[model samples]
Target chain A: MALVFLVLFVAFLLVLLGRRKPALVVGLIGLLFAALMFRYHLTDQVRLSL
Target chain B: MQLLNAVAAMVLYSVVLGAFWFQFGDSELPCPLCLLIRIGMLATAFGLTLNAFWEPRPLHYGIALLGAVLGAAISLRQVALHVVPGTGSFGGAVFGFHLYTWALIVFSVMILAIGAVICFQRQFEAQQSPAPSLVRFAGRFVVILGLLLCLANVIAVTAECGVTGCPDNPTGYLIS
Candidate 1:
């Protein structure tokens, strides 16, 4: 799951770089990855506690 | 823009060093894998500062490539430590992936992107010779100072880590 988000984030970065729209695209992709990772990590914690 | 980049690089390096100190003083001691990540961060910070100032494209590319290599190794080790517990030691298992992994990945990506930009910018600058002397001088100064700061932080962190023994918590709940 984390790997999936990592690949997507890297692809988005490559696209932004190719298109010369790095700032916006990179920022959005970074945020998306962070959100996904946060969700996954929190879920792990909740599961462990339960 | 160069100054901003240099400052950001410096701040990030300082934060990493501070984290190391906090870990030694408060939390559990860092394992070999954690130390590798710290080394990678230090290298990336150094490269970023150098890339910000150095107009020569090749030099920037070299620095960035070095940083990327270090980052890739550390990130891979970090992932492996989490996924394949037995591959590393108890210390490695204790110090699993955290926010530091994300920071390492971001640092690597930033280095690669900046390297590409430097290559493109170099070509543009070549067409317009006689670049501003002050800008070049300032960039050189920043690069030198940034390298020195990075070296100092790396030394401090390495010495501190060496002085402490790895702490273990069988329950894996304790902060230390």
Candidate 2:
């Protein structure tokens, strides 16, 4: 999770540096990590009861 | 102008999330389809966040496209879940169909519309001169991110759904 934040921060910095393409690339990668985390949350547990 | 659209998207997504929370409270777990929508929402939020920081136009476009595609996919799934009883649990069946699903569909359309506007507006503005290098770079980045995120999300959902003997509880008990 922290790594995701770190990546986002770096991506933002890249954007600030006028590296818009890389920033977007890194942000998408970060989102992928987030999705994986969400998947882990969903599958690792046995059942989700409301 | 871009910020306005991004803010609007964020507002719409917040409503979607709020509706989901309201219908199911905090306890119920999301199904595979529902999880996909959540991923969509997160992507939109991330896009909005980047937009808020004035990252670049490409990032904005990417966010809008990602949100739109995810929204469309989930809405279609919700429609299927509504039409087909046991195809997949649509979560608590709030508002005739899953509220989040409906929200995702609506949000997706909005994002797509916003994306179209952004693209056309840029083209119109650039008629006389070349698009600024940074702006063009941003656009490419966004389009690529949108495509990749959508693909990754679909793969994740597919893998989860393919597993045998998945739990049947409507409100996902996994979170609890």
Candidate 3:
């Protein structure tokens, strides 16, 4: 989850610096991270049963 | 202008850093929703950092607004979960406010501030020229710190959760 934010932050920085292509790539990666996190959270699969 | 934005970044980072300290100092592990809220705050700070670096466009504010709204939604959901009488919160309180409540306040303020900036565009417009070297230096410095903090968080979360992922009520690290 934190990695997702890191990638997203980097994408934002790239966009601000006018590096369009890289920003787009990083943004997509961040979205992917967010999606995975959302899926795991929703499914309740990540938490231990304990 | 750049100086102001850099200061904002510092303040924003400080808040997040404080949260991290509290989490570790109090020996509390964050749930998924808590992580999301932190991401939201980072996104808010990213928006402000953009303002310092580039021209003011609707896109920049849009990113911040989206993050803020998402974060607020998660915070609210958590509040709803615990709002029922006799429901216990996950962590200890800070100044009588839980972390999620503070998150709610921050997200709400960021939304309003971004909305206001969008409405009063001229007042917050960026300068035409490239930022001065000093301004650029300050901006980059703070951004670098943000990047480092994010990286640190990634490492810490990975260490805590491992491949299986964090338990809902994480008392200690799962792997070890």
Q: Using lDDT, give the best candidate's number.
A: 3
TM-score of 2: 0.53
Following a full C-alpha superposition, what root-mean-square deviation does model 2 have from the true structure? 9.9
Q: Score the docking of each candidate (DockQ).
A: 0.02, 0.07, 0.28
Question: How big an interface RMSD has model 3?
Answer: 3.0
Local lDDT at B6 for model 1: 58
In terms of TM-score, the best-performing candidate is 3
Kindly report the root-mean-square deviation of model 1 from the true structure over all alpha carbons.
13.8
How far in Å is the alpha carbon of B87 misplaced in model 3?
0.9
Name model 1 segments beyond 4 Å from true: A1-50, B4-8, B11-15, B84-97, B122-176
Docking level of model 1: incorrect
- Ten-residue region with minimum lDDT total, candidate 2 chain B: B167-176
Q: In model 1, which residue pairs have backbone atoms overlapping below 3 Å? A: B28-B176
- Writing each residue's lDDT as its tens digit, candidate 3 over B7-123 gives 766766787897788778877788877776677677666666665555455665666676677778778867766877899886778799888888898788778866765786573
DockQ of 3: 0.28
lDDT digits (tens) for residues B2-67 of candidate 1? 554455556556645555565656554554445445544544444454444543445434544565
Chain A TM-score by candidate, in order: 0.43, 0.77, 0.77
